[model samples]
Target chain A: MHNPSQSGASLEISDLSKAYGSFKALDAVSLTARQGEFLSLLGPSGSGKTTTLNMIAGFTSPTSGEIRVDGREISTLPPYRRDIGIVFQHYALFPHLTAAQNIAFPLQRRGMPRRDVAVRVAEALEMVKLDGYGDRYPRQLSGGQQQRVAFARAVVFKPKLLLMDEPLGALDKKLREDLQGEIRRIHRSLGITFVFVTHDQEEALALSDRIAVFNHGRIEQIGTSRELYETPATEFVARFIGEANIFSGTLVRGDAGLALDTPVGLLPVETRLPAGRQASLVVRPERLEIGKAPHAGSDPHVPATVRDVVYLGSNRRIEIVFDDGRTGIIRGSGRGTDVGAGERIDIRWSIADGYVVPFSSSQTGDGHGS
Target chain B: MLNDTRLRWLILFVPVAVLGVFFWYGVADSLWKSFASPEIGLQNYAAFLQSPAEMAVLRRTFLVSIGVTAVCLAFGYPYAYLMTVTTARLRTLLMVVVLIPFWTSMMVRTYAWVALLQNNGPLDRVFKSLGIGGLALIGTPGAIMIGITQILMPFMIMSLYANMVRIDRRLLDAADSLGASPAVAFVKVFVPMTVPGVVAGCTLVFVLSLGFYLAPVLLGSPQHAMLSQLIVQQVSQLLDFGRAGAMAGVLLALALSVVALGAVLARPAIERGYGENT
Candidate 1:
């Protein structure tokens, strides 16, 4: 029940639920966006991210809920009256109009003078670095250029809020990265509330001031990128954000915090646990240390046999199988220390590098355990 | 190479040979016969071009075809838009209804219009019961127009529906989110996007209307003879082959020129409507 402050055009959605007959598209979803903040809704396909966006855009109504912007109830307002800007995945520019005309579409609707609309259209196109392209039809421009025109057309009228649904999904990888940075820059410059939807985790992490990670029609976690990445509240969040090696074990009392008795070895962890409870330990691959020795007992080391080694340019990923037949991945920067398949090595990680997560049947079925 | 060349020549020449013998021969023979006797050379064509009655019939035919094309485009656009937005099951059902008219013979549909428009028919009786008299709709140009419109509307709807279905729904949403109301979106985005469909439907309806015979002859009066009806009267009633030949040639030329002009005028709209780069 978070109510956004009314100082600016903040959007507050609460208890938003939508169902299509028997299938629930969004299940009691709720979130809020402060004015001028770039908030991204990040999720995989069928995770209800687009559904939540469509609800906010007023293209689709919530089966039951409240959507308020600037402290005014706009749940039932038609999309046109909502005065929101939206950039689609396919960049729906009018084929008959040039870039300038497309940008002037919304302004013309407001009955602005032709000269004023022209000035604003030029400004919008310049903002997107497409100033000289105003006279060219969308067909004459490249895909990336057309996408910029779509962005200009959406924001030319200076709407209160902007919605982008996978706006970079159709671009090449390098172009997508470039546009992601450009979008963040524009958001900062315009200081308008932007609600972006994407299934790519890296895009969300790179661009959003705050991200709402969705799963199974519900928000699994919503926090700053660092907070969500470092201290994920659930196993789904931990695995979705980055690669993680999870281990199933029982917790025992330790001097520092707790100890997990896994099949590979007894490992220390930096999380509180009931003395005799079952828990799962999750650690990032980059946090693991692989070497010839355990470095004078800095941390408990488990002997493992190298199974596979993959070169990833900046880093090398080594897949290893422990003596107890448990497999895990360790990522390290490229170095002279070469390890091949079937070679024995010792893997070590600090207790503070891992967190305790609740074990679920579905989590075990994913086969992501170390 | 020789075998392939022989196969290609066979494929090309069979149709050309049949067309030359069956179609061209008959048309040439008609032209020859039209000038064979009784003031030959250009007399029949001169008579057809000079007579005010013939001129009036040709003008009426053009007016009726243009009118029917306009009526079909006006009604078919909204019907096609509705079909595009409806549920799949409902859209299929409505499409079936639009196409069912085509499955029945055009003559049967025109006859149905005749039965409905007569003084003692269901429509006239309803109008009479509603206290609206002095209609006198039967055997009039208005009745002929109605019959032509009804018979030709399905072609317009089907052609427009095919093109409308290909439009991306996201464009409409983009328009709405940019502050265009639903009505504005339809007029600015949807209507412009379906211009090719409009052109195609209009051309089809107009060309078909130009050549219509049974409907105008059955539903129209003697004074309302269209171009085709006049051609039939010249050839059969008056036994004037040259005049009929001239009229037929003029009708063919007019229909083809209109089609060519429509295609030229519609080029930009079609390109704009369908170009994916936009």
Candidate 2:
């Protein structure tokens, strides 16, 4: 059944729309996934990430759309007939069956020989490193163990595609990180297409080869993590992906790129932008430097008061009160930074580290960034 | 601290005293009366055990009760599952329909069954209209079974529905995504999860059927006399309180044993269900 030459399957979704009465859960959503790629649907709560997943999994029918797997339309197929595996956020293990029986359920349904079923079940359990726990019922297992059993059951059938809906959302931070690595490793070993849904930006960025950031039933941006983080097309993407310090200002003229004239000073833009456009400059917290010697012949120097200083283990996060009264964060190695609260300091960043995002009136007012 | 302790003991003792005087004393008095009658040496119990007529009634009662409980479970489980999976409005309507039969008295419900099942009643009339013969449905064991099932089905459905509704829906979805069909998911995931409710409902229906009087009295013939009807006959007609007490004791013992067995059987399922859900 293994076909090395036909390893990848392309999934194409076109103009998918789903509505619960008047409320549009998913609106004209469309995307494509190359085989053997890990794609994440990243969004906040009620942002249609799970809806999109349900549609792809055949658990839900889109109001209007088409889904084609390897160029074969499967939009109307039932979930079981679709031959796709899914892992839920709650790790829904069968309570009556032991881990081995749960993993063997699909194989048994297909009427495989008893000996072959046993071997495959054992292999699946071993793949999840749960070899010794085959006889344990779901209730006897811990949360992480149950999640691993769920993963084993999903992958036991070697499905063409796998859908995971916030599968690690219930685990603790340490466990979540551990299982994230485990899931990535499993994906690599299996070389199966995986579409994951998560509201957690860090998890999505860490695991996804490409991510589709969703907001209010629409895709704000879809790109690789580096592309989305370094050059976000919209303010939502900029704020959702990482901590972005946004300064609302009008674009000003500069020799190399556009500059932002804000309450602090003229903030130089990292990426070139159209001049005289109303824009907001985005600077990642780690990119901004505090208490460093000024670069030679830099034009803009914004002096600000240190509102607060938080001691992170690796770096000191300093909150600066700009001359116009907005706050910005700057990260420095804790050893060299002696700037305390109420002290005046000069905060600066390299011109290439700050980029301009289009100013939107509906953006959140928290100036300390995303 | 001393006053608080005294008040707490006083509060606890009040209910304990009330229960002891009002409940335990009556049962103990009945047990003493059962054993101590007509020369007082387990004569009533020996007579009850030795009499084939009495033994037949006991056997028939157990059979009928088991039959009724089985029927209730067979029908109630799917109804409960549908209630859990349906939309909220439809579920509420279905629940109301299940409960609507309970608002009327059991005797009235039994009489309604009589009206529907009698030879010249609506059921027979419908059969006759279809060119079929009028069937014998009343004053038989079948009538008693139907009446009991109709009255007892709600208890099973409501109990099972409560448990089934509380099940995590994600569990069912998970089974589906793992390539199990709907039927497989229901049998593997849902049926096992609702085992506690099924056991509870079965126990309740069985124990209640064991002591049934009205439905059997009204719908069954003299040959189909249940334990409760026999006890009433011994006390009221034969004026044999000793035999009646012995019969009552048997019924109580059977009911208690069944309840204990049910608790023992249901504990693991309940623990596993709750454990997995949590």
Best by DockQ: 1
Off by over 4 Å in 2: A1-8, A254-257, A270-272, A291-296, A334-336, A364-370, B1-19, B114-136, B274-278
| Residue B123 displacement (Å), model 1 | 3.5
* Deviation (Å) of B156 in candidate 2: 1.2
Candidate 1 lDDT tens digits, A1-370: 1232322268898999999999998999989999988899988787899999998889999999899998899988999899889999889998877889899999999999999998899889989999798888887898899999999998888877888999998889999889888998888777788999988888888999999988878898899999888888777778888777777778887675578888977787767567677877888888888777544664756788899999888889989887788788889885523789988888877767888876644532332211
Model 1 iRMS (Å) reads 1.5
The candidate that achieves the highest lDDT relative to the unseen native structure: 1
The regions of model 1 sitting more than 4 angstroms off are: A1-8, A254-257, A293-300, A322-327, A334-337, A363-370, B1-45, B131-134, B273-278
Q: Estimate each model's TM-score.
A: 0.90, 0.91
Expressed as tens digits, the lDDT of each residue in B1-278 for candidate 2 is 56988999999999989999998887776677789865577988989989999999999899999999999999998898889879999999989998899788998999988888888889888888888885768887789899999999999998888788778888777777766789888887878777778878898999999989999998888987888899889878998888888988888999999999988878777666552121
Please give the CA lDDT of all the candidate structures. Answer: 0.84, 0.83
Q: Is the docking of candidate 1 incorrect, acceptable, medium or high quality?
A: medium
lDDT digits (tens) for residues A1-370 of candidate 2: 4552355467788899999999999999999989888999998887888999998888889999899988889888878788788888888787778899989988887778999999999999988899999999888998999999989888888887888999998989999999999999988878888899998889998999999988878888899999889888778788888877778788888674567888766777754567777888777888876654544457445777888989888788888888787777778785557778998777677777777778766643331121
